[model samples]
Target chain A: MIFYVVIFSILALLLVASGLYAIIQKDLLYAVISTGVISLILSVMFYLLQAPDVALTEAAIGVALTTVIFVITIRNTTRFEDENDNNKVK
Target chain B: MFGDYQNVVTMSVYGSSIALILIGLYGVLIKKHLMKIVIGLSVVDSGVNLMFVAVGYIKGGTAPIFSPSVIDSKPLMVDPVPQALVLTAIVIGFAVTAVALSLVIRLFKHHNTARIDQIKSLKW
Candidate 1:
């Protein structure tokens, strides 16, 4: 019981922290990777919560497919946030 | 100790899901980059799925699957409906993401930029 609580707390903390990092990180690649980390942690959390099916789906779609697609998109475009000219009228 | 742990488990699970949803909302609302917005949408999708699963959980319950080897005189199983619904939601979310990325690609090709503010050709 105590063990479960400890593990859950740690995973939850990591999940939230990684989520914040994913949103705030300047580099788009790092942000995408952090989102993948969140998905990975989320799958583990699903497993702990006794939802193996959801966990499996999350791992496959969220972690693998999403990251791959994002990376491909990044490769085709810019990888960092352009702070100065982001809102300039063109 | 056991009782306290149980409460913590339930509260933390639901609370974390809510926190994720709110954080995702912030990203979607505040971020300007197209890819970041898409990532935020994905995060929001995950949070909603997590909440659905967490809500369907039953304390001290096992998976809904029935296996002869694990038979018990009395069985407690988590709700299966939310799990099924979430499966569909996850797939739909994936489809939505693919389409969104394709649109992003198209936009980048047209404007040579991924920032939403700069792509104003359609703006009235």
Candidate 2:
């Protein structure tokens, strides 16, 4: 009983922390990776909450496919948020 | 308030998911980069999926799968409906993400930029 509580609290904290970091990240690639970490933690949370099917789907789709797509898109474009506009005067 | 283990666990789970959703909303509203916005959307998708599973959870209940050896214990199964619905939702979310990314690619090609503010093709 106490074990479950402790584990749940820890996972919840990690989830929120990673999410905040993902949002506030300056670099696009780092933000994408942070989002991937969020998904990975979320999958484990799903499994701990007794949804193995959802966990599997999340792992495959959220972590693997989504990250791959984002990486490809980044490759085709800029990597950083201020990469192109850093030298411009506003 | 954490004395009741089950209630506390469920509440915290739901609360964290709600926080995730709100964080994603902030990202969508405040972020200027197109890819960041898409990432926010994906985060929102994850939060909703988490909420669905959390709502459908049954304490002390096993998975809904039926086996030859466990056919007699029908009452121990958790709600299978939400799980099935989430399965479909995950697939649809993947498809939506793919389509959204493709659209972003097209937008980048047309505008020569990925920043949402710089793309002024449809702006009035």
Candidate 3:
């Protein structure tokens, strides 16, 4: 019982840490990758929570498809988020 | 309170999922880049999906499957309904993300920028 609690606690902390990392990341590509990490950890947690089906779906879609589409979009647009324009004088 | 060992596990799952949702909400609400907004939305989806499964999970529960080996352990199987629902949610989330990204691409093309504030002030 305590073992399960320990594992859950660690995974939970990791999830929140990665989430914060995703939000604060300056590089769009890195932010997307962090989101993928979130998905990866989530899939593991799903399996631990006794939902293998959901875990597999998350692994396939969240970890793979979502990140791919976002990467492709970033490739077409901008890799780094440009925040310099908000302060420019008109 | 973390007095009980079981509560720790349950609280961990619930707390983390909620934290993820909040972090994503912050990203969506405060971020200027269109890509960041999309990322935030997807994170929120993940958080919700996790919460769904967590809500359905039972302590020491087995996978909700029917097998001859476990003919008598039916009562220990985890709830399957939330799993099915989360499956659908995950797929729909993927579709939504694809559509959102495509829209971001279009916005970038039309406005030549991905910043939300800039896109807002400029002619589309």
Output the lDDT of residue B74, model 1. Answer: 54
Which segments of candidate 2 are over 4 A away from where they belong?
A: A84-90, B1-3
Q: Going through the candidates in order, what fraction of the true interface contacts does each contain? A: 0.63, 0.67, 0.89
lDDT, model 2, position B93: 88
Task: Mark the 10 consecutive residues where model 3 chain A has the least summed lDDT.
Answer: A81-90
Model 2 has an lDDT value of: 0.84
lDDT of all predictions, in order shown?
A: 0.86, 0.84, 0.87
Model 1 lDDT per residue over B4-100, tens place? 6877777678877888899899999998899999989998888899999998988788888889866765588888899999989988998999899
**RMSD, each candidate, Å?**
3.4, 3.1, 3.7
What is candidate 2's lDDT per residue for A1-90, written digit by digit as tens? 798898888888988998898888877888889888988988888887678898899999989998889888877766777655534533
List candidate 3 stretches off by more than 4 Å: A83-90, B1-3, B121-123
List iRMS for all predictions. Answer: 1.5, 2.2, 2.5
TM-score of chain B of 3: 0.90
Q: lDDT by residue for model 3 over B12-80, one digit each (tens)? A: 999999999999999999998888898899889989998999899876678988788778755577889
